[model samples]
Target: MKIIILGAGQVGGTLAENLVGEKNEITVVDCDTSCLRELQDRFDLQVVEGYGSHPDVLEKAGAEDADMLIAVTSSDEINMTACQVAYSLFHTPTKIARIRSPNYLKYKEKLFQSQDVPVDYLIAPEQLVTNYIRRLVECPGALQVMEFADGKASLVAVKAYYGGSLVGHALSTLREHMPHIDTRVAAIFRRGRPIRPQGTTIIEADDEVFFIADTKHIRTVMSELQRLEKTYQKIIIVGGGNVGLGLAQALEKSHPSVKLIERNPQRAEYVASELAKATVFCGDASDQELLSEENVEQTDLFIAVTDDDEANIMSAMLAKRMGAAKVMVLIQRGAYVDLVQGGDIDIAISPQQATISSLLTHVRRGDIVNVYSLRRGAAEAIEAIAHGDSSTSKVVGRMISEIKLPPGTTIGAVVRGEEVLIAHDDTRIEQDDHVILFLVDKKYITDVERLFEPSPFFFF
Candidate 1:
């Protein structure tokens, strides 16, 4: 695939790095010479130094024959305009834009259609991060929660605790513990190394276990690997930015004890007026006095989502130090995310990963509906629809045991219409079944895509 990415920022750089290794021709455009040079040094891709929305710049970046044009520049306007230019001038087949502002997103349904901005797909990092954090808030003790099959089934990651019922047991014992409830252990990482799960494999304490089950049964399965945590209340959010406000709005109805702290008094007041239940404070989130007044020691969850990575990390560290039970920070830089994770911060939220997943779903072949980048892009949890008959499709009529899944890949579950069935050896995939799979290694993603796609010889 030949692609033009309209930014050399975190999202663009990450996307370039991911696709460059996958046999795709990637060209990045940006105004910053230093940023473009950095990406050029790291990846084997072309770089155009100019305003991405400019027509000449798109032509210089090979947008004419590009398979996709991804506009993820810092400015929403630039991204939106770049997509319009790509569609109007180059006639690019696919155009994806990263739109952060909630105001524009409010009118997105009517705005981004072909008749208007012509953006084929819109990637809302703020909204995606909001949903990501909301899932973590809803399912306590989970390192990550990725929903699939329209929220009917979810893939959850949790650390195996020492005293958990299934911590020292073989994978087969999970069925014994919950005979009535079916679930699949997708993959396990022991000390940061992938471990392909098998029925005989014993789960050790401290291992990161990824499992798939019905969304309602998520907590029940979580308890088997680790002790269940107390439900969150008294949530404090730092920054009045889009992500912070969006999260506050989403949590307000369910959690009335939500508090939002914004350093800017005006934005804080606006947020206060918008939210009926959440308490809004116009003060520095890192201020000891302000946090003390709010009783940070008793706060169940403290989130720092300021635009600045340094500010978010520092404030979240202070919150954790001040005795917040759990602290989640929204960090964009990949380096910062690695540094903060497994330290003071409980979860380092990365919008880049979420954005990448959204983009990959569109880039991937066949009928993949949803994709979640797991374990920092090394793994992937995908939801794909099975199509065609026995002769036409590689997966449609095959049983779990009969299918040739890529190495380290595991079929987790299948959502057939309204039913969520945990994938078993005898489980057979039928047409239109939404198959959820976990791949410990995504290098064979092409094979997975081919498995879902109908044979080339088949007629439409």
Candidate 2:
């Protein structure tokens, strides 16, 4: 596939790097000669130095014959204009633009269709990051949550806390506790990569565990682990940036006691005006004296979503040390994942990483219905739709053992009609049922898709 990407910033550069290994002919265009030079040296691809929004520049980059064109410059206006220009001049099959403004996202569809911008997709990093964080809050016990096929199956990250029933037990011994539950410990991300667990693999305290299971049995699995599910009441957010403000507004509507701390008095006043319920405090979140004065220890959940990684980490660490029940930090740096795994922070959300993952999933949706990079792309939790014309349709009503599944992939759940089926060997798939599978390799996307026919509701 021939792909053209505008803006060689963090997200654009990350996308180029991920797609380089996939054998796609990629061309990146940017006004900054330094970024273009870096990209050319780093990846096996072509780079064009020019303003991406200009039609002549896009033409020079071969946008006319490109399979897909993506504009992700820092300015939303530039990105939108670039997408429009590319679509008008080149008629690219797929056009995607990154618009960071929250207000623009609200009317994205109307702007794209009515205005005839010819953009097929809109990516909002802030909204995507906030949605990811909201899922964590919704499922408090889960260390991470990856929804497949619009909520049919989920890969949930769970931690075995102190005194939990499954804390000291081996992975194989859990069958006695959950004899009827249909789920699997697909992979264990101990330090970073997926570890092959044996029957004797004991669940350690504070171990970040990933489980592939049906959406219905998620609560059952958490209950068996003896993790308490509590509704987040009092919430404290440290930052008035787009991430923090967006999250605060969302939580405020849910009636949670929300407080926002911003170092900038002007930004704090703006957030306060936007969120009347949330008390906006003008002070440094890393200041222990200020946090103590604000009674941060009493907050049920502490969220550090500042623009600075150091500030976010320090604030989250302070909140945890001060006895906050839950602490979540937003770190944009991907390399810091290792630092967070050391256990000072409960959860670290990276907006740029999430954006890259989301975009990569979309680009690879030729066969896969849904894709979530678990354990930082070590394993994937994918949802595939079964087609009636596929070879696997003959085993629609047969047991899973009878069907020939690809290697390194396991059926986690099957959604037929409105029913969420916890997958078992005896569970049979229907013609149009959505099948959720976990795969260790992403190259199996086509093989999994061939198992079923494409569904109309598969993609947005």
Candidate 3:
């Protein structure tokens, strides 16, 4: 696909890095010449220098023949105006803008129309990040939680612990441990390397295990890999930015007590006024005296989402060392993500990785319904619909083992009509079934997509 991206910031840069590998024609537009130069040196794409919303800039960036325009500029007005310009002037088929303000998104029905703002898709990074964190808080010990089949099924990732009963056992023992609840071990990782799972494969401590099960049985299934922690009650968030404020507001109703700390006094007052339940403080998150005064030791979950990565990391470390049960920190750089994961921080949240999955789902070629980028984009779990009958399809009517799956791909679950079926070697795929697949390496995405394509017999 020929694409034009507005903004050379974190989200735009990560999108380019992800899409460029998939063989897309990408052109990035931004006013920062140095950022554009850096991106150009890294990837095979074009970069135009100017205000992203400017007509001349869009035209110069090849909006005339572009199939899609993505406006992820920091300014909401600029992003919205870019989409409108692309729609009115160039008639770009797909216009996706990153809209942050709830006020604008609240009127999405009226604002994003062909004759209005003209945004085909509104990608809210702050909302996505908040929801991602909420899911983690909702599930006590999960490193990552992804819902499939409209929340009927879920994919959870957790680190195996020495205390888990099944920590040093074979995968087959899961059934013996809990025979009633059906589940599947989708994939496993050790030291960032993929390990194909089998009945005889033993799960060791420190292994990152990914599993699939019915949503209701998720907690039971997760218990096999790690000791489940107590449900979160008291929470503390460092940073009064959009993500921090949004997360605090979302958790205000469910959680009994929520505390937010902001370095900026005015922003702290604003956050306190906006939130009815959450208490906001104006102080440095890394300040040991401030954290102790706020009773960080008694907090159940401490999250640092400030703009500065160093501050977020330092604050989270202090919180954990001071006796916080669990801590999560947001890191934007991919290099820093690996350095922090499985370390002092309980979970490392990547804003880029979270935002790119939604954008990539739209960019995928097949009829993909959902896409979850995992392991910092090293792997992906996708839900795609199977079309055509046995005569015209490679998957329909074929047993799971008979399908020519890619080297690192595994069909984890299948949803047919209203039933959810865990994938087995003998399980046969039927037409229209929503197949959920896990690819340890994302390079095989095209191969997986081809397996569901309709053959020439379908046209006859």
Candidate 4:
């Protein structure tokens, strides 16, 4: 970890192309000499050209043996003055920054401890793409959520349509139709990686599962997979910029029934005077007759946060071929999120891979409290927490096939107390458990934090 990124754009060249092959030591900076000669002909880093908030260019981009200094400069005061001069003259031990001013994330922790601007972390890909479209408009059929720690383990993402009834169900018969539900069906991105379902992993109608629960049983696995869609009362949003004006001012201050559309008629009258009860629609969202003359097939949810990724994947596949039903696409090109999740895009949100997975989980804070980079980053679900002089006390109650993990890491769930195990090998991991591992090498994330060593809150 000797990072040092500073804006080469597109979230610092997608966080130096996903920290290249992770043994760290990156270095990027850039006053665009052809984006530092196209990131030095594509990665083997150390690019540095100039002006990453000057000071002799953060001391020639080394920033005093930088262990992490990010600052994604699309100028929020030059990424908070290049992470406050690399944390006040190169004391850079994880400085982060990115802040796109929604009034600097509304007083972000008293401006990071009263402007001691050594921004330990601040990122705001328009508030992480409007908190990832307000967790898919507050779970209106949950096609992806992921929250961990603060909410305590969760990973939602559903989508099995046709006659729903848990389509051809399996994975242990949908756990005997929720016998006191303690969810798990961990991975199943079908035509992608993360599978391990077996018991005839059926459930395929529109198939895009990923459950792993216990954020209070995630509404009992979205009410036993009928794909719960109660709330979201009409919400269209095709792109007015800044993640569609911060998701139409966060669904018009959480009142929903919003609309937006904006194909720049002065940014649709500045998002209709900053979302005056949404419904802006100034024109051309790749006009399928103006998205069926603005009914987008009776929208229930069709967020396609514009800044053109082929007009947010062709207006979210024309609001999922005009039926809407739920279609989210914000693709800030993380390699086109697998070509708009191989079409039919029902949840693509990338905002530069969610601000480089919140700046590599805040430069890998102590024993990783969170870290997502799923599918395309091949794997890394993380969340960790176990400490208690962690070595995970030699497999706390051992079973995960008798604990010798580390192959491409797995232990998908295990929150303990509020129960959410999903992990097999007779599920155990006790002491303050928060587990959630998925890993596929980030250098074995400190050997999966020494098999979950003693961690009782010590976030860097």
Regions of model 4 farther than 4 Å from truth:
1-75, 78-84, 87-90, 99-124, 127-140, 147-154, 157-210, 213-224, 227-236, 245-260, 268-292, 297-300, 304-360, 363-422, 427-460
Query: What's the C-alpha lDDT at position 200 in model 3?
Result: 98
Pairing residues by index, what is the TM-score of model 4?
0.37
lDDT, candidate 3, at 89: 91
Residue-wise C-alpha lDDT for candidate 2, range 1-460, written one tens digit per residue? 7999999988888888767766689999998999989999999999999889999999999988999988989989988888888767778788888989877888776788625766788888888888888888877777778887677667888876787788889988777888987677766666555565567888877666777676777888876665677878888998998888988888888845888999998888888898868889999988999889878888788999988999899889988899888899988777796578448787877677678767766677434566676555546676666664333353455578777777777776787887777677788777777777777665565566545544444331
Per-residue lDDT of model 4, residues 1-460, tens digit only = 7887887887788678777666777888878889878887877888778878887888987898878777787888877887777777777767777878677678787777525666776777777768867876877777667788676677876866776666777777777777877677666666554566666877777677777777767776776666466787888887787777877887787765788877769878877887667778788777898888888888878877777778778777877888887777777667777666645886677777666777777666456778877665666677776645334265555567777777667777877676566677777666677778766555666666656654444222
Assess candidate 2 and give its lDDT. Answer: 0.78
> Per-residue error at 265 for model 4, in Å?
1.6
Cα RMSD (Å) between model 1 and the true structure? 1.6
Query: lDDT for each of the candidates?
Result: 0.91, 0.78, 0.90, 0.73
Q: State which candidate, 2 or 4, has the greater TM-score.
A: 2
Q: How high is the lDDT of residue 237 in model 4?
A: 80
lDDT of 4: 0.73
* TM-score computed on alpha carbons, candidate 2: 0.88
Q: Considering only N, C-alpha and C atoms within 3 Å, which residue pairs clash in candidate 2?
A: 143-157, 386-452, 386-453, 387-452, 387-453
Give the RMSD in angstroms, all C-alphas superposed, for model 2. 3.8
Best by lDDT: 1
For candidate 4, give the lDDT of residue 412.
Answer: 71
